[model samples]
Structure formats: C-alpha cells, structure tokens
Target: KEILLLLVADMKAEYIPPREDVIMQNESPDELYIIVSGEVEMLESEMENEQTVWTFKSGDMIGEVGAFCCRPQSYTYRTKTLSQLLKIRTSNLIEAMKTRQEDNIIMIKNFLQHHKKLKGLRLGDLLHGVGGDYGDPNMYVNLLTVASTGNAT
Candidate 1:
C-alpha cells in the first residue's frame, strides 16, 4: 500500500462506474492502474466468446505486465463495481522504478511469488501460462509434465 501510494501520489485518480472498460483488449494502453476501491474483471475475448480470466479488487495493480514489458494488453479489464483508480503512465512507472531500484525489485519478486502461488498448483503449472497464452493446451500439459518431473528432451 505504501509503495502504491508513493507511485500514485503524483498521478491523477479516476472514478469509473460499474461495467466500464478500464483496459480494452487489442488496444495498447501505456498506463497501469492501481485500484483504490471496487472490483475489476479481466476478460479475454476470442472470436465471439469473451471469457472471464480474472477479477481484481482494491489494492490490486492492473496492467502491470503491459506497463513493464511495453506490450499490448492481452486482456480487457472492466469495472465490476463503481471503482476508484490511480493511473500511472508506463514511462512514469518505469522512471519511478529506476529511481527506487530496491523497492522495484521487491515488487517484481512479489509479483513472481504471486504467480508461483496462483491457482494452488506447483512449479509445473507455472509454465501453463506460456501455452495458455499461445492457445496450446497440449503444450501446457506437456510442459507441466516435463516441469513436474524435471524431464527434458
């Protein structure tokens, strides 16, 4: 919370009503949002189907990956309820990180730890994201098998 406060102290805050899109799929947003209140749902739209990939609430950082990697948002985020958010442009976020190297590393470590603990799976499941993003379920399963047993070919 302190870290987020520091990051957002100089940024503008926005209020979004329920069901409004925060991050649109296929549109690259150069900013990351720190949710101050309310819920946001992350959705992935493929063809005519839109799937709920995740839901984030107060204190959660949305669009971190895009902000960190400078890539287009792969999912769309919409408010599930009335929301209050602090927006930090990617350039500013990067600059802040650069100025606070130790804190930034800790933040990155926390994110990695969160990913490791995600969905209650072991190390094997970590690689599932790689395949899932590429639309290859078989590859995920295969990679899980390999990762779990420490087998390589």
Candidate 2:
C-alpha cells in the first residue's frame, strides 16, 4: 500500500468521456492509466491473423508494459464510458518505487492485475490478455504446459 499511496499522491485523476483514446498503438508509452471507475478497452492491431481486444473495468492498470519498459505501445486504450482514471507518468511511478531502501523495501504487487474473468472481445471469445497478449490459445497453453510440466512440448 505504500507504493500505491505514493503513486496516488503523484497521480492525476481525470474524468474521461466515452471513446477517448488514452494510449494509441505504436506510440511511445510514457504513462500508465489506472481505471478508477467505469470501463476501458485494450485493442491491438491484427497480428498473425489474430487481433486481441480486452474490456477492463475499475482496478485495472493499462500500459504498464510499454510505460515501464519504454517500448512502443502494443495496444491502444480507450475509455468506454465516463470513466475516472488515475494517470501517472512512468517516471513518477518509478520514483515512488525507488524510495529510501536501507530501512525498508517496496513491493508493487498486482500492479498489472488484469481481470481474466472479465469477458474477452476477441480470439473466439477467449480470455487472451495479460498472458503476454499474444492472442493465441496454443501459445498460452504451451506456456502453461511448460510452466506445469517443467518442459516444453
């Protein structure tokens, strides 16, 4: 909670209307948005004949991958309703996580917690997000297989 408190202290709370784009595909992702209330969608362009799209609600954080890694955004995020989003720049979040270390260490758990149970919008209605966003069931199954069996098939 220390990390979240620190981040929220520096984060900006905004009321976003429907159809507003928070992050665009292929853009340099500098900030991460946390859905405070309402819904957002993560959409990716077609890749290997499969496109991934996910509907995320409150408590979901989007764009952390690109924000933290400084990679091109793999997906675009758009608000679906009058959503309340907590926006924080990557630098600020990093700063929050980098508090004085000698006394205590910080752990930001579930910072990227995606509600896999929340319905998926693509890949034959399969829950395909936050599993590397590959949009392939076989890929996810293989990962699970390797994870459980300790060997790749």
Candidate 3:
C-alpha cells in the first residue's frame, strides 16, 4: 500500500523476534507503528489479566490514537511472529498530519462513520442530519459540510 510505505518511510525501522512483547497495556507512549512484515497481536488487560483483541498483519497501522492524542496505550501489542516494524514518533506524525490536512480530514470522517456503525448506530440515522443519499460521494459531502460548520462529524 502506497500510504503504508510513505508512513513507514517517516518512521524508524526495527526487527523483532517472534513472541516479543512490544507494548504493555496502560503504558503511556505516543508512537505509531506500521507493520512492515510478520504479525502482531493487540491485547487488553484487566485486573492483572490479559486478553487478545485482534491480530494485525503486514501493512497494518497500529497505535493511531495513542500517537495522535499523546496518551497512554490502551492495549498491549505483542509480536505473533518474527516482525519488522517502522515506528513513527507522535511528534512526527502530528507534523505530517498538519501538512496533510485533507488526508487527516478524510481519515477522521471515515473513522467516525465506522465507529458509529460499530456502536450500532443506523446508517440512515447517521446520514439524517445531512439529508442526502448514503453513499461514498455523499459521505464526502457530509464530511465537507461538517468541516465547514466547524463541527467535525
């Protein structure tokens, strides 16, 4: 993926052996990691317990929010296999986002829609405020409208 490659180029590369634990739950670190090769597991911990959340493969982006918000990592990341990663510091990503405002806007819009859907919000209701057909084009228009209104949807 071109975007992945571009982001990776902005990061520091590292090779990790299989079964290596990369991030710990609740640990504060502001960095985004791109998987260049192999696999990673995202996990959650509660009351001294750990649970797997998802598995990420090559080209997958990890730690986006932690990087953007400069917050503690909410999940733990572990190497499922021999993994190569490109680690982008939060400051660099923030600068990149600033330089690419359009990309950031689009990404945020998509993320919001996806998050709403995941939370069981109906597509119709999500588009109700915009009063338009629900489609990719309409989604962009809604995003633009929300942006113009100084309210990012």
Candidate with best lDDT: 1
Against the hidden reference, what TM-scores do the models get?
Answer: 0.70, 0.64, 0.64
Which scores better on lDDT, 1 or 2? 1
**Higher-TM-score candidate of 1 and 2:** 1
Residue lDDT tens for model 3, 1-153: 444455656879999998888876656666778899999997766888877767778977666645543445657789999999988877766666565657666656654554354344333332322233323435544544575345873
Highest TM-score against the true fold, candidate: 1
Clashing pairs in 2: none
RMSD of each: 6.7, 7.2, 9.4
What's the number of clashes in each of the models? 0, 0, 0
Candidate 2's C-alpha runs over 4 A off are 46-52, 100-108, 112-153
Model 2 TM-score on a 0 to 1 scale: 0.64
What Cα-based lDDT does every candidate model obtain? Answer: 0.69, 0.64, 0.64
lDDT of 2 at 89: 92
For model 2, residues 52-87, the per-residue Cα lDDT tens digits are 377778887887756544456767788888899988
lDDT of 2 at 2: 68
TM-score-best of 1 and 3? 1
